[model samples]
Target: MPKKLKLILINSSILLIGIILIELCFGGWFSSSNQLSNLGIIKDAKFEFDVRNLYATKKQSITYTRDKFGLRGISTYNQPEKIKILTVGGSTTDQRYLDDSQTWQEILEKTYRDNGKEMYISNAGVDGQSTYGHLKSTEIWFPKIEKLQPEIILFYIGINDFYRVNSDAKYDDIQQMESGGFVSQIKDKSVLYNAYRKLKGIQKATKFEVGHRKINFSRTPYTQEEIVNEKLLEIYDKKNLTAFKSRVKKLIVYAKSVNATPIFITQPTLTYRIRNGVVYGTEATKYLEEKYAYNGVGYYKLLSKLNDAITEVAGKKYVINLSNEEDWNIMDFYDYYHNTPIGAKKIGEKIYQNLTELGFVK
Candidate 1:
């Protein structure tokens, strides 16, 4: 073959590869954003919004134009003075499956009105968040809530913390968890890393192999019980559980300092009923199966240990154990992590009962 011909062939091949990479990245093959947007779910919007503003510092103002998940547009902070309740949590507290009106925050507000108590509840919940996120929200937005002079602050968390304590993702510290100033600790230098991700997306889209023999698209094979138990133990032994307990204690103290009652609600999980069954699997399952293997007794044992730590720091009065005897079912969850609208309603009711007992309301 002539040298010129060989050179031309090599250049063409490189151009083809570059074109494929660009197509993969932009074609919704490499990321779920495009596909998820089509679903028109609030959770999806929240996730996409967070990703877009991951590195932003200022509050991204969002208007309530429509309900992707049945959320209602109650009076914003512009309304007349009223008793204010600030609720914080991950997806469950966020009520991903429920519309804004169906959320427990709204439910609690309506409940207050029904009983002749006038109050305004602000939903400060975010999806895919953790205890760190809750702490971040309190730090950044507590003042905004304080401007309203909120009488109570409700915190529903735990599941995300349980997952994040073991995952590889380096999210913001508690201080900046809600700030949108996200920066990955992992360096983006590996050509292979970028190429692998791009190629994976292309394979999913075109279903054609350019170089690789086969493409694998399967759920991470692992059980939920294993993942939870592993993460739970990691939090315990690494003293993360202690750190978390301390953070909760500090949050409560801070709330008291501001003259706002702080109430901690232990968010429920889907496996509440099937305590003996597995909860997760897929590629993500390998992390759990390899790290933490716990039986039913072992699982509850870890919970007891963590509960002791929390009890020691938070006292029984401030802590609301909503997971203890809740009527949870598999159908209540969209996945292994989040709860349905009805499930969140039950959780909201439990929280209301706890608030009543704590004298936050009549």
Candidate 2:
């Protein structure tokens, strides 16, 4: 091995590695964009949206889009007349902060696609909606989407309804469902196309926006000690339970009307933390106390009660109560009730597995 020859080979290897890294980073592998809320943020005639109000300040290059049917992920222009699954819920299900590639709905969609299965799953999540909103959806929204009925309607309930337990919050307002054209730009296979999108996104984020202000994500982290104070929260009131039960039943009825099976899934809150293999049940931000009479501990407990109501009302066989079954670290959520990408992946995978086990997805 001559000295000059050895040096040339080493330099060539370094160059090759550099090229690959650039391709991966600038390629679709690492490129992403925070889609404008206009693309999927669900602005009903009733929603007086301030973009600042709907998303985290620290926007990333994550793509989020909704079809005319208001379903997240790929547009219905590419879907079958009868979609297989539709997940309904509030912000947790809407997953506004997550890119289309990262939302649990899309994650579920990809899983089926990868397994030689072609199942179309749409996300019908709206921020701040509850069972009440879903009932409204059955009436005003879902009926409008043309030939877009799903076989399984996953009702990811509990979190937003938790507020209505002891307090009076009109947690209902979601856009009417829409169905139409959309192709997923999130995980495009062409690296060149991805690169072009990234450049445009950079421009959009920097100089293109005048109506939106850049707000950073809240960095404050909560601890179980800070949120829980030994006193237990009261079970959700019987009146609320009755109302909640009625709502769930309505959703079920709506599902049956569409020949869809309604499965009530209990969504977990960011109220608790997981540490050292032990799970802490009641824990969330102290700021929650401002909105509700109780702290995070109470919020967690109350939400669980609402969860129990759904299970008890809808029957456990039709519910996947992630609130009681899953354990996620604080990192799973940006706040008390929304998922980060990491959190979304865990959730999406879990739901897919549950559906498979339950024979909802073959």
Candidate 3:
């Protein structure tokens, strides 16, 4: 063997072995501690997060815990087999402000256990994510959970997708905000790297835990004329509608590919209460007039259009049209759409009822 070539091979082998050792020893500890292991994936995550919005159900600090899979909701590490159903969407689904046990997914799981059915609903929601992010999870997030194939994937969609359609807010996207790419994959697999990153995250994450989350806006009530100023009762961007349909179908196909059923839960909103021209809202919702400028009613109209598209694409058999349900009022919600604990219970119960009616859950 040539001396130079032999030296290169020996050095390469040493480097590889050292890296593997670092991963097994340091990376293993780091990933497990940071809630990024069991999938060979590292997420930019903290052990806990706190949010304090004036609209939060309680004034206390909201603790968003890191479950075993690095996602929100209860840990299924010991009982992954029982996690047959999952609810995915945006903040409404994540409900960072709500207590862990107060989320609808938790409620649903408890309800099932109460009924002698032992199905667990893994909460796979992310804040500020849209249909684009949800579809991305079909490949990135959900599939990574080893030994788990959800039987039913419930989509609490529409509201976040609504933010994307007519607006150009530079918000959350998996590529822009989440981990990916070659370097990212390598880091995700590296225990030492994960330990360094998690330490940095914990430092910054603490900043979010303190203080009151107060939303202060001019208390201006848009008149009925201003609320429904649009001449068109139905209006939506065609391109947005098309893209939304494609994503929903793709998600459905991906769920079926994993031998799981995809059920589209049409999102309910405070807009559902905008029935009268007067539109006298409660104090909690008085902010909506200021929240939606100029075309508030038109915004509701667009959300309906998107929900309709969901039904059209997924078919009526696979949809839970929450817009059609009138039993809930502003009291059920903390803000525009995010549910309170009481609201979460009602929603969980309602979903269970729908699932039973549709025979998705026994």
Cα RMSDs, all models: 11.8, 18.6, 9.3
- Tens digits of per-residue lDDT for model 2, 1-362: 99999999999999988867765655444332212221223522111222334444354355656665566656443353747888888777887656666788878888888878888878788765667666656755667566876888899887666545333422221221221113333323335444564464445334312112322234444445434323224324635666677777778888999898889888776555445644454423442223334444445656667788788877867888677554675556655566767778888888888888777776
> Weakest 10 consecutive residues, lDDT, candidate 2?
172-181
Model 2 segments more than 4 A misplaced: 1-59, 75-82, 165-235, 274-292
Error of 2 at 254 (Å): 0.7
lDDT of 1: 0.51
Write the residue-wise lDDT of candidate 1 on 129-172 in tens digits.
Answer: 55654554455334433245557777776655543344322432
**Candidate No. with top lDDT:** 3
Tens-digit lDDT string for candidate 3 (1-362)? 99999999999999999988867665534444432342223243444344444454454655556455546557463355667787788778877677777788888888888899877677778665678767756665666667777788899998766644233323223343344566655544566665564464344323321122332223424333334323222224445576677778878888889898889897775544545433323232212212433244555556678899998999888998776575666557655566767778888888888888888875
lDDT of each: 0.51, 0.61, 0.63
Ranking by lDDT: 3, 2, 1
- Model 1: how far is 167 from its true place, Å? 7.6
List candidate 3 stretches off by more than 4 Å.
Answer: 1-59, 75-79, 166-237, 272-294
lDDT of model 1, residue 131: 64
Q: Supply the TM-score for candidate 2.
A: 0.64
Worst 10 residues of 1 by lDDT: 208-217
How does model 1 score by TM-score?
Answer: 0.58
